[model samples]
Target: MALQIISVVLFTVFFSEALTLMCYNCNTTTECTQANCSSSCSSMTNHNGNNITFVKKCADSAWCFNSSINLGLIWMSSQCCSSNLCNNATVSENGLSCYTCNDKDCTNRLKCKGGEDHCITATGESLQNTVKGCASKNICDNITLLNNTLPQQHLSSSCCRGNLCNNAQKMTQGPVLLLVPILSLLFYILGLF
Candidate 1:
């Protein structure tokens, strides 16, 4: 009887762990349709990675930061949930709008240049050693700055963005289906004991 109970507990733990692990690695393709300016706007991928081929139309002399831009297609790894996990991801800089993961660090940090141009000060004086005119192009740039400047930085692009938010949805199907039967059997055996 005790052995049966132990088996049920073990099965429950194993099922939970497996489900958690699977969920960690699961990737869902969420469409940013609202950001799509035109009917032709569509995301595509190649051997490299995901790409946002469409470019947002720039209005007048004002350079459009492409706030509608797709930052990058991030695939959350199995270790994403843990504290020591490699949350380090990537972002696209070029028109392709993609990123690559070599190690754990995000390869492309500079996306749009933020429309800020840093030039040498005219004075060339020792007192004017510091570079100036380094300001953000968008409100989002301020958030990125905060992430870089702060110590305990928890800057997640998936957080604020609606619809595309990766909130770790529960697995309604897949191997979890197998776990259900196993769990039921374990419970039945426990009850018999």
Candidate 2:
């Protein structure tokens, strides 16, 4: 009986589907749908003075800082969380910080989003300019060769730990703002109905 009970427990633990997380999956100005996954992510991108927010279900739990690529002039930052409908709540940007440079000089700074713990520097992607920003440790470790390569160009990248360690000529960190309490209050008020 003891062996039978142990087998049942092990089977349940290994085959449980309760670990799946519900996330809001949507792109810029698109319809939001529900998805089940291991992680939820909120990505914010800024391009040409415009900001767009995206939410999605993710397999990996990680985030990124102000990263720019040769595709366009933009910055992408993502926040990941693990809770039921947690992506609907505010994600804290209290992670690492890094400098982001697209085509212009590396003067702007981007705050690291959730789970982004490493700073990355990449250059030579046909554009022949350097881009520095924060990235998740997983991406840095598993995506070295392609760091400087994409479908259209060749690229090279290096990763490092430490805040603002991307080695920008002028190191500047983005402003850290807290909005948890306010969002909570807003939700509480709405729930009063």
Question: Best candidate, lDDT-wise?
Answer: 2
Give per-residue CA lDDT, model 2, range 56-129, as digits (tens).
44436543222222112343334455776655554457566787663455756778765567877655435445
Name every residue pair that clashes in candidate 1: none
Residue 97 C-alpha lDDT in model 2: 76
Q: What is the C-alpha RMSD of each candidate to the true structure, in Å?
A: 24.1, 12.6
Relative to the true structure, how large is the alpha-carbon lDDT of every model? 0.24, 0.51
Per residue, candidate 1 scores C-alpha lDDT tens digits across 128-184 of 111111111232333344334332323222113222122222222222111222222
lDDT of 2 at 180: 18
Query: Which window of 10 residues has the lowest lDDT sum in candidate 1?
Result: 118-127
